[model samples]
Target: MTGSTTRLFAARLAGTSVFDPQGDQVGRVRDVVGMIRARGPVRVIGLVVEVPGRRRVFVPMTRVTSIDTGQVITTGLVNMRRFEQRGTETLLLAELLDRTVELADGSGPATIEDLGLDAVRSRDWQLTRLFVRRGTAPRGLAGRLRRRGDTLTIDVDAVVGGVLGLASPDADQGATNLLAAFEELKPTDLAEVIHELTPKRRREVAAALDDERLADVLEELPEDDQIEILSALEGGRAAHVLEEMQPDDAADLISELPAEQAERLMALMDPEEAEPVRRLLAYDDYTAGGLMTTDPVVLAPDATVAEALAHVRRSELNVPLATAVYVCRPPLETPTGRYLGTAHLQRLLREPPQTALGQLLDNDIDPLAPDETLQAVTRQLAAYNLVSLPVVDEDGHLLGAVTADDVLDHLLPEDWRDADEDDDLEGTSGKEAAGA
Candidate 1:
């Protein structure tokens, strides 16, 4: 499974085994690290290797004796410390794969498909070649079948600027290629990718994402990242993104900003969208009112099962919100008329479509008070085996619901969002690990 090979491509190096001089398996390559500059070959710094215990460590190119078939031979001396990328380092696969770069002499834009590294001297390597596909990726079947742009390998020097050009921080390195590459990733996973990028690049990517997508990603990101990305956007766009986020989540983030800045963003948001977030902001952070989302499933008691089902089936509704339908007396929106009871999806499904939600209301459990403590909320949810508990005011107006997820979010450590998930690393030779 190993032999010397001079020819190599950066994309091909991913997940290749790294062996010590005696052929003892040490780890597998997750990413190739390099220092890219404005107008020169990118210096290959090392390989990001995932050692046992799912720890990623740095193996300098000097320690690499051979880039071989199915494996890489190392000098055995490797830094076991977890690899923490310096601000200057670029992860070739994570940052450069599918990056848009301009071809020399204005031949137009091309996307980096792969990069080739060569040994220039004793124990030194440089990224000297780029394999690229010209133009934006094809779309429909015709676009896929029709003649696409040429794919070719050229000198690294032939490609200029964009993400590779660290010398120009403000240069508009569009995120088309980056977004295309990661389009399938979920919000949480995409947040992890964004977490590794430089501040400038992060801003570029954030600007490129649609407001709703950006909002979802922001909700999953660390607080600092959320603020940084939000701060980078124009005031109007930032407000729009806030409107897309869950009211409770948006309120939490806004509460962290300076009072003046928060007010400015709030003023820019549509009054209708700002109202729920503003209401959530007024509650204590750990109370039921603060943790609950103001946009839960709420309907008048006379609303038919079919009508409730239509709302529950909406693609935008989250799991906990869709699990039940709250029935009230008059108004249907949160903080509406007298709180009656809730109808779980199971009962809704079994009941006739024409049956009024009021007919199947489950009044067994008492609703939570708006000012209920977090401890009280948790006890209620646990005691009733409920995913969500309705919250109401003393005057009997239905407020919102506190879901299990919301409770878990507050119960976890403050840094829980920042901590990397311990995904099982049982299989080797897969896509690069997150944070690598």
Candidate 2:
């Protein structure tokens, strides 16, 4: 227990491995449990650790012996029970990262980027410093040309002195810091972070993301989360986000809402953008039509290999959707003129740039019918060794394309997204190790 006072940033501690004195890993840190007071600094209570089964357990600060950049060392027997939040407990990452607070210098409100915890004694730790940012961080061109915001660490007591520490549940908070921290994460990873937050905070964070970004995250979330977050947005904004999502995804989400609510949102959406979603909604949820994406790469039969390559090169296109370019007669959009055939990317690359896509079409495989069952779609993809397949109507017009990912999503267990949320262990607080 005798060592220089240890200081660790909450962000650094997050996800760091926790180990026993014998060098055996116990679990990874999910979050820091702290006690926020009406005055003074927040006291570090324990660490929320996720074990092998995704069960969260508490390891008190009293048991911690070492804090390093990559790992935490603890003494005594570790508690294995589920870590439930007490009335006085706060999850630093889940509740405080994006909180907007007034600075003591009167320079304006700042967003908390990270927090620093210091060991006050062998068994006591306290939140002592706040890493925060202030100023508008405009995105796109402006973000690239200019600096984001002034970030610095200040005494935790500065803002916690009075009633200005963390904002209330309903208070308007900026997600700049939190979003910045998660900027490099994939949509699925970001969805996991958002899934752990409280509903109100989740709504605030969702509101801060742009329509396209929100659409990406929403697609990766569970059905209930998608419904909740979408319902919380203003009608127009919600419609815009839906428009950014894949037509099939947007249709599925809309179908889950109450009829009146769904109608209202669809009405707010641009008619041109809502058309494809509306079309998909007419089909059964488990059918090829419902699972197909209307925005897959499409090209006219006469399009050159170069043009087909260009369409597949779009940065926004997902891998499966970009794997092949559907070559149709005229009216290249979904429900396209004639379902000619698909020109795979590999084939396109092998052809001369000036060669027409129609010459490279792979029509040997039959396209899927809109009414085809999800199981049938899966079988087709597997049997054909294809990443995506075209969906055509009875009239031989292309409706959309069903990708491997879409089929896998439906075939997986319904609670697959909730795999990390399982909390079967029941208990209040976990017991400390056997000995001091």
Candidate 3:
């Protein structure tokens, strides 16, 4: 059955059984599980098999031999007595089940209901994990819903009933239908669907998505989509999404665009909003300096709580929503400012505003050279858990700044390295491959 249905919908495998070579029933498949790596499709690693009248067993895919419509085939024909009943250890299930999984086609979230496994061409065969629909069903369900506009609310009892051949009686059928429909969506169409959603809806969709699928959709999006979606968000919502994106990416989206348009969007945003973007705009778009932002929270070491509060109020207009405040002296002999340490915002807020900034200063802030590569900057930011890193010239003068978001944009799927490699390869070929 696995060979006959190489592309079977994962949701339809909920009730599928597993068997050994001698046609002996082993266990019923409970869930399919694996991690999605950077190199390929989701790799299936094991199956959570529940044997009737017995405990559950986590059968590694290495034990699978083949698959068919009614049952999965395994390598050894062991007796039912030989099967070990493992306790309810959901480690395997937890690894693969109940995750906020996404459909590769539409990049939408679909709950995993169970896993299906079969061994074919290899000793270990990881089967695909089944996905069930939950939460508020997608809109326009008249043609899509199982009962024509009826929402399918998933619960533990409902899931158990569906697997045990009770309840709605058509749950598997409904899931299969939904999976097929989702598979039909093109990448561009998926992006468009995401784009039309409201900010909350967009976040839901993004959160439901896996990183690679999200990256694929992001790669295909037009520049406008990038800017509009990003500009509308703030804090972790904006940061997480952008973090998954490449630095040059977020930069490119904001670069060369109308300054007034960006300004308008920033004006409407809170300090967190206007700051990161404004920092990016400060860069040259073509140079590293042009790609940086300067919205990190800054402080003078001698500032008191009252003074800090005053600074917060005054600088609130330009400062990024920051986790730490940097302490620095104004530029002495250079155009840019000298290097300093940092202070925690939480600490400052907890103290009286009149507290001195110097006492609060943490003097251990990591600083970045303006010319550092985006990759280097990303590593530093991650190491410090910083929201933004200061960029300075060799003389310890501040140039601008680079936010975590900027680093993320550059790290995304823009193919800068590949493009360079291709250019180098073409140069080496020197009309040989071209002539051929």
Candidate 4:
């Protein structure tokens, strides 16, 4: 009579009753939250439910006792607060419902009519399968997934799909066409969208972007997310993205991975690019050695201001918040040379271009020891009011440099990466309640 409920579509799950063990109605299913794993299928992490007084709460899949017959039963314990979507969370209703996606196992593409969810014997909720309409979806479905449905159920194994695009009132771009539109987005803004997509869709977009652009987006992501996205990409492609990243950022991501895994990724990179990261990996994550990037502009101490400026211009190094060039002695190659002193951009502007940089060097500016603690590094950056600080060994040889942005990444709140997303949406009017 109900058109077979073996696969419970999210559309139907929406507004369904959620009850406690005693059969007490707790709330209604508001949204489904999931974590996009680096490999394998995306996993259902929890559920967003709306209780009395219009409050949203997170109920982990593990806490869910059962889901069947248009009813969700939970363990009763619930945190009463509006659900704040983290950078890693994807709201099924908001991000995936009705989106066009390619069906797994060669079933062609289909509009994600609705997502089918089920509870296991252990009472953990998960995406058991998906429900899609097998028909020509509207072209250019950018932000919205679907407008209507035809009702076809597919098993979990047969449902691997990526975002074709959302069919929303705002934009009409298809899933395959999504990358170009996303390319035009600011890195932070694109980071938000990538945050809301599953790994498959994320990888699709990642592949579409050039190494430099993808590197920019990856830089804007959190360490965990940065690793996840990189992990999903092919080794060569991942290496290229890493090549484009600032040495410190790349090292930061690589350091989080297992040694063997890290080695494998590094192997695929260009030798010159790999050299700096390999050196960076030798430092403790909380130390200046670990925080510094080898991509800082470097010039021979004997070089003139013109040469120093030229070096900065010619090198495609993407150092963040960088405004200085390190003057080193002799070998101006990979794995570093003897550090002489630092020279800021302001110094270059004040001095004539032909002025020999060695004369203009600020050797009095204290250089950071590789083993210096993060606190010490922060203090130094703050005290000097410098955009970048050099890291050196006991011999005063330059190993790398840490930029102001790198310091902020460590000092800011855990959610700072996506906090601005909420800020951007603040003034815009939307009917959907905070978690609804």
User: What is the C-alpha local distance difference test score of each model?
Assistant: 0.79, 0.79, 0.48, 0.68
Model 3 C-alpha lDDT per residue in residues 258-340, reported as the tens digit of each score: 77654444455455544545555655553446556544456566767666565556632333435556667874222336656
| TM-score for candidate 2, residues paired by index | 0.78
- Residues 1-436 of candidate 4 have per-residue lDDT tens digits of 1222334556666667887766777777766887654444556788877655445567787777667777877666665545678976677665665355556667576665566665443644466566677654554222234444456877655645332122121222134334432334567656755665666556555655667878988988777778787887788888988998878778888888888889998999999888888888888888888887776787887788887777666535544423788888767653457888887877888898888888888877788888999899888888878778888888867777877777778888877653422222222111122222
Model 2 Cα lDDT, one tens digit per residue, 1-436? 5653488778777667777767777777778888877776678988887665455678888778878668887774566655667888888877877566777777877667788888888878988888887754443223323455789888875663433365354276556556664566668767876877778878878877888999999999899999999999989899999999988889989999999999999999999999999999999989999899888888888889999888888898999998999989889888899888989999888889999987998989999999999989998999989999999999999999999998888889988866544333332212222111
Which scores better on TM-score, 1 or 4?
1
| Candidate that beats the other on TM-score, 2 or 4, i.e. the better one | 2
Alpha carbon lDDT of residue 210, candidate 4? 67
> What C-alpha root-mean-square deviation, in Å, does candidate 2 show against the real structure?
5.9
Candidate closer to the true structure by lDDT (higher is better), 3 or 4: 4
lDDT at 318, model 3: 31
* The best candidate in terms of TM-score: 2
Model 4 lDDT-worst window of ten: 427-436
Which of the two candidates, 1 or 2, achieves a greater TM-score against the reference? 2
Please give the RMSD to the true structure for each candidate, in Å. Answer: 7.1, 5.9, 16.6, 13.4
The best-first sequence of candidates by lDDT reads 2, 1, 4, 3
